[model samples]
Target chain A: MKKFLAITLVLALVVLGVAAKVKPIKLGAVLPLGDITGRQAANAMKLAVKEINAAGGVLGRPLELIIVDDEMNPSKGAAAIDKLATIDKVDFFIGGMSSGVHLAQIPILKKYQKITVWIGAASHLCEKALAGADWYFHLHPWDYQQGAGYAIGWKQILEKYPQVKFDRVFLAYEEGAFGTASYKAYLAMLEQAKQGEGPYVGLVKEFKGESFKSAAFGGGDYRAVLRLAKEWNPDAFIWAGYDADALPMMAQAKEIGFAPPIFIGAPPGWPADFGKSPLSEGVVLYGMWAPSLNKVSPVAEHFYNAYVKEFGEEPATYFAPLGYTNVYFLVEGIKKAGTLEKEALIKALEQVEYESPLGETLKIAPSAVIKHQGFTTQKILQWQNGKQEVIWPFEVQTAEFIYPFPKWEGR
Target chain B: MKKLGMLIILAVVALGFLFPLYAGPYPLHVMTTVLTYMALGLSWDMMLRTGQLSFGTAGFFGLGSYAALLTTLYLGLNPLASIFVGGVFAAIVAFALGYAILRLREIYFAITTLALAGVFTVVARNLHDFTGGPEGKILPSAIFNGDPTKVYWLTFSVALGSILVSELFQRTRIRFAITAIRNDEITAKSSGIDIFKYLLFVFVITSAIQGVVGGAYAQQYGFVSPESAFSTNFLLLPIAMCLAGGIYSTLGPVIGSVILGVLSEYLKLRFPYGHLIIYGVIIVAIVLFMPHGILGMLKKIAQKTRTEVGGNENEK
Candidate 1:
């Protein structure tokens, strides 16, 4: 009995010593893991951590990713972030895919003063994060850049076709920060082009004052708005919102004859899966980066290929690039910082100017207003035969533009 | 027997008060959420006593969130004081609403309250200018400068107060009155028990306490939206905890909340996608195996042991 006890004790001590050998750098991701977008983000983060660990990890310590489900809801996000910061004592944060979730997480982030990288776009999230602390590092391109880019693409299209003038442009956006900001920026772009010194003039005939409609974020049954939009007889209609509204908008718009000549949406509203629907044909959208373009960079190619190998499928969302790169930005920041200290990490993140997977030098603005929102230069794409094809930034254009949306004929 | 129970209560509270001293931020936050469930379970149990099935915890919770948030924002009151005001505001609304809805019988009452909660969500969504619309309002400052220790104590105090109130009610003559109403409303009415009056009184008090819980929620997390405030989890989780803990008793709710709360956190960790599924399974299991809850089963065992021991002594 004494001999057996001695052997067991020796074995226990060996196990404990071996366990102590590994010092892990804990990282937390707050995402709606149940939802496809969040699940993709979580998978991408896990893949990145695995790769980093295989590459001898960060500062000789293995990177540990702690993922918490936010349920794509604000309260749950705040609670999850609280758990990440307070309970787990995470070294960093790479999360907030939904603007609602990000907005909820802002206060907790400020309280913890942890270095966080953004994966969600609602420019207001940046504004809120910046207002609270200097530790927030946003990677997602803001609504202004994407909205203006879409407007410029529309301008180029209009300038190319002389007779195709957008006499009336109607804007219907969800009342959340992303939609609201993008709508305003697009409106400002129309006004700017009209007022600017350009050979690209006479594209916008008139900007109606009351054309902007702000839909409640969670309101269902959009048939009333469809009726109003059809009656207005708009040459161009802009639908700015998230996927929830966007999915129904496609079905409901086709249900009524509300198809305008020119239709464009902001990033997430144009989900890759939406192309599966026949109603998705001819809908133009803008994004920070698309793997479909593939010409973004070699880093983009590598990330896409790795995701396919790890997950056994193509990433069907634009958020994968943003989610995958957000972790790398944090890892790069940690490398630059050299130490795990909060102040050092914050300073290093602020100074980060790494070439991202999207082939752009990811960096933050100096001010709180647009801090870390420098991932501009979005691509304009249109859906053709259930496949989204890049049609703008002429250098990256894989396909030509399809002008004047055709009406639903005998569908 | 009373002294022993009181001593145990005191001991548990003393441990709870010392929780932050040893715990880190995450455990403290989780415990704070547990306290929230405790208060929710206890408050729901209070209403359940009077044969009233109200599915309007979300309605009152949402109303309290807006009330507290608006009070702090516009009135510029302190968070604690704002929470008090919010609770009172919810109680007032409940009083008025109970005048109409508490007269409902069985499923009608439950359905009405559920519909009322939905109505609160819609009203909060549409009233954008006031309640910050659907996006929710992040308070300019948190209660106690976002101190986890302080937040834990505050939530603990509220939950403790609710549990004591529940125990006190169980001890009082109001218990028999409510029990009579629950057992048979027609018989109780024949015997001069004012059914609506008793129901309204219990509903108002339970709702007032629940409102305080909502106010604490707004102050703690520092934000509340229509969706956040009116999440069905608020309604369902408490009911599940109460039923699983053994309904209509203080001991039942206390045990129920702790087990369900810890189980939920564990399941969330174990299977993030299926936590809701796990929660449903737990409720079903509790209903099937232990219809009377863990406390009821324990009570039965304890009684049996006492009877057998007494019989042994008699035999000797």
Candidate 2:
């Protein structure tokens, strides 16, 4: 009995040792899984992973996902990437929701020299790689492109509000790199447009002493900030921020009677399915491609159908498309690279030019912006009645822009 | 006896300093955050020493982080200078607020501090002029420049410095006055101890320490949002660590931080959202089973053993 037991123990030890040596394809998912954006990104990624594994997996080896929670924090996001790279021994990383989180992980990703496929970082600066980081690949549309789309919509609103002829546009953005860059782009564009346009001055206000560099709300109530805006009496309020902030700010602005003719917001809160917040209607939101609306491409139908069949909900927001496009393109890159090896994967990713569910074929760029395709730009959507409708980039117009907010008379 | 204790502590400190070098990335990150909590816990105890319970450590922490983040982002200040500036800002704010609120005793003091933290959070969220509001701020890469190992070293050094400062305060006449105040504030005041001055001094100094640690933490983590900085987790964990380690003593916070910090990491990994429950259970059990704390229990055991040995020697 002792001899048999010893043999069994030896067999178990050998099996355990062999199991440890069997290296699986390690793919890391760095997400804000506990928060709203993270939850959506994680769920979408899980769905993609499930579909991939079912479809014979990547490189004949089952793909394993090691998700690290960024907790919607930039430092945590970087730390999550560090853990994924050093501890999990992942081959590559894919995920990000909050722009702050993405910007935080950029330097770390650069240091580690890992191929990171950004799922939802709208910051054009991160996409540009001012520091010249090549390993970082952004799958989502750049906010600058979205800002331009917003400018197009703003052009119409400005024309509509010609009678209101006012100066000073208040720019309130999140203090991260993404928000700062977007704000700069928006400000520059507005400045050029508002040039010599009669008392049309601009007052860029952030909190006292601290500039809008580090995502501080600048140290006062949104109502107080709005009151300051009321004091300034800007022609409009151009807020480039995510859902977590925009909803409450709008509520507070309404409370304090700072109703501008236009209130424009960015991705996180601008989705048509922003069901959680009561301030869902009337605010003009700019987001990346929503699978439900961006059905111009044939791939959208297949993706939309598959997503609905699997998840039991329509793909109303960009979460599904972002996840689907990232995984689909990543897998395509893996296939093109011809191996699951890191260098091969990166090489393949660089060579990628595949049609995504969002209708555009994503091409990897030699420049910092990894995905170089025409569709890798943002679109403007407005919350009319109860749902978001694509209004800008007139070519793909699902709906027309509702001119003048609050007392908006025309659609 | 002091020399022996110092030498033993030196060895432990060296180990604490060196472990990050050999540890895996995950463990190193956990240890870094542990050091952050250790600094927070010690500072909290220092304030409590003056018989003032502050619920605004998170507020000061949030403010310090913003100060560091803002300086680094806009002014392009050096990392060390940013941390110092953040600490100074927090200390000044604490000094002003402590003067106004320190007159109230016990729960009022606690509630007032809690209200102060809420005000800071509200300001952080809505102001949108300085802070990013709900989106939070992204710290610049210039601080430690994305080197996790270097950041770990920074945290260790800061934690050590905070501990030494706390020890110095403990051994001072100020500490004796604080003790007298905690035991009997009226008597402490009657004995020529200006209660308000000491209270404000302790509050400001402790807030400065928390701010420094908070600044270091913000840079180390590379992001600061109102929610993450002012989260109840930050406030609760440090208090739990100080109380569990045996509050009012230097060793208690240090030891408590080590245990709870490690346990919090493990629980977070295993249970994710459910770990808070496990954390509450462990804390409740510890508070119930050993009211004086593990260290105090160990001292009692040692004294009893020594007494038994002396009696045995007499019998022999």
lDDT of 2 by residue, B56-172 (tens): 888898889888878887798887889898899999999888778988889999999887767887688766657766556665463667676788888898889889989888888
Task: Estimate the TM-score of every prediction.
Answer: 0.87, 0.75
Interface RMSD of each: 3.5, 5.1
| Candidate 1 lDDT by residue in tens digits, B41-109 | 898899888887888887887788778878898788899998887789889999999999988989999
lDDT for each residue of candidate 2 in A1-411, tens digit (9 for 90 to 100): 999999999999998888686666677987765554555556666677788889877776567777776766555566677778887889888877776567667767777776678776665545543245555677665655554545455455456445532244567755544455555665555565467331222322221111232223343245555676667666566665554465566667767766676666653544334545556556777666654464466676777777778767766557667776766677788878878667677777788787776545677654334444224456667776676676655555666565556641221
Worst 10 residues of 2 chain A by lDDT: A206-215
Q: Which candidate ranks first by TM-score, i.e. highest?
A: 1
Off by over 4 Å in 1: A1-24, A59-61, A72-79, A82-88, A121-126, A129-132, A142-153, A156-167, A172-222, A240-252, A265-273, A337-345, A367-370, A374-379, A392-395, B307-316
Error of 2 at B4 (Å): 7.5
Write down the RMSD of all candidates, one decimal each.
5.5, 7.3
Deviation (Å) of B236 in candidate 1:
1.7
Residue by residue across A1-411, what tens digits does model 1's lDDT show?
Answer: 999999999999998887699779998888887777788878888888899999999887899999998877555677788788777888888866776567656766777877777787455533653564666777665555555555577677666676665768777766544454555566666766678833225556655322222333446466776677778888877776776666677778888878888776654645557888778788888765666566546777788899999999877776677778878888888899999888888778777787765646778664337445546557778888877777776756667778787677754
Q: Give the per-residue Cα lDDT of candidate 2 at B155.
A: 87
Candidate 2 lDDT at B159 equals 88
